[model samples]
Target: MNAGHPIPGPASVLAGARVMPVLTIPSATMAAPLAEALVAGGARCAEVTFRTPDAEQALEAMAAHGGLTVGAGTVLTPGQVERAVAAGARFVVSPGFDEQVVSRCAELGIPVIPGVATATELMRALRAGLDTVKLFPAEPLGGLSTLRALAAPFPGTRFIPTGGIRAAHLAAYLADPSVLAVGGTWLATPAHLERGDYEEIRRLTAEAVARSTS
Candidate 1:
């Protein structure tokens, strides 16, 4: 274990999942129910972003639930890496590429997917030994067309487009082998999670899975 870190790398985190629902934990109470509901809907994995103070607790809560894979998103610092791994996060994702964060995650044995919006950032991530990366604010970065263009030079790289993705965009993205998975909040909106609407979460997850795989 590098630096005493124990979890496997990012490939394990992806786990062939078509959708990695980006989630915000409003409270610890929302973690387990949301995890169970996501698994019930066929998306057995979830990405709880470190966008709030509740993130660490929520990551811990979701990781405890059986049969669900939990990841930490919006990770930006070595401190966050230590916190996430301590909280049982198997993987970490950042808004933009940061060598320090990626290196820290590597030492801790947690897989990381850093965001890259251009060839330069992609090259940097690739140089960091990351074959897969997230495209931040994916739509404004040019969406699938942009992704297709970016991938032309790096055929072996895979992407997890995280921003602005909707149910309608899933099919096209998944159809391309370069897209490992799609991440977004639309699958489990804050409103649904806040209201404890697990059924809606499950239903949306199921449709997303179906659409992506179909």
Candidate 2:
């Protein structure tokens, strides 16, 4: 499936936001607490990935918190999209684009941000009607330089660069008018979650938001 087509909700809910937190949590129980930390710390959006076994439950937990714009990430299949939707995911994101997944999400009116790595893949996504995409492994894929190259051709597109992204790159990515936001897993690492150090998470969230808007 391709990207350009609109997903029929509030893209602004995710777009241009200062911080878009990406997390791979281990259990459903941590979702609320972590989400609370993020919001309290100033982040109002997140992408909860399915890398862990309890992803669906975690999504449910986070959704129940209210006020957060939560998206399901690492979504690789139609089945996963179904589960994520059932768990109340408002949007779906993947490391790469899959025609079947994109089609399914569209059918259900769910927004999808599929990954693209090159000019060819970016065009492929655009052909499939996707205007918003995720640039995975951002730094390895050429980081800010690659984004600049992409903008020349896909002038109307918006991106959310994930993977290998750091706090230092926040301003560079967010400064671009074509960039919607960025995703990274460092904010909610296992060690911090294990210790339930929500205060630190809140601090980091504030710092990330500040950097993105700076």
Best by lDDT: 1
* Top candidate, metric TM-score: 1
Q: Mind giving the per-residue lDDT tens digits that candidate 1 earns over 107-197?
A: 8767889999999999988877778899888988889999998999998998989898888888888888888889979989889987889
Predicted candidate 1, C-alpha RMSD: 2.5
How many residue pairs of model 2 clash at the backbone? Answer: 10
Name the lDDT value of residue 197 in candidate 2. 89
Candidate 1 residue spans exceeding 4 A from truth: 1-9
What lDDT is obtained when candidate 1 is compared to the true structure? 0.86
lDDT of 2: 0.84
| Least well predicted 10-residue stretch by lDDT in candidate 2 | 1-10
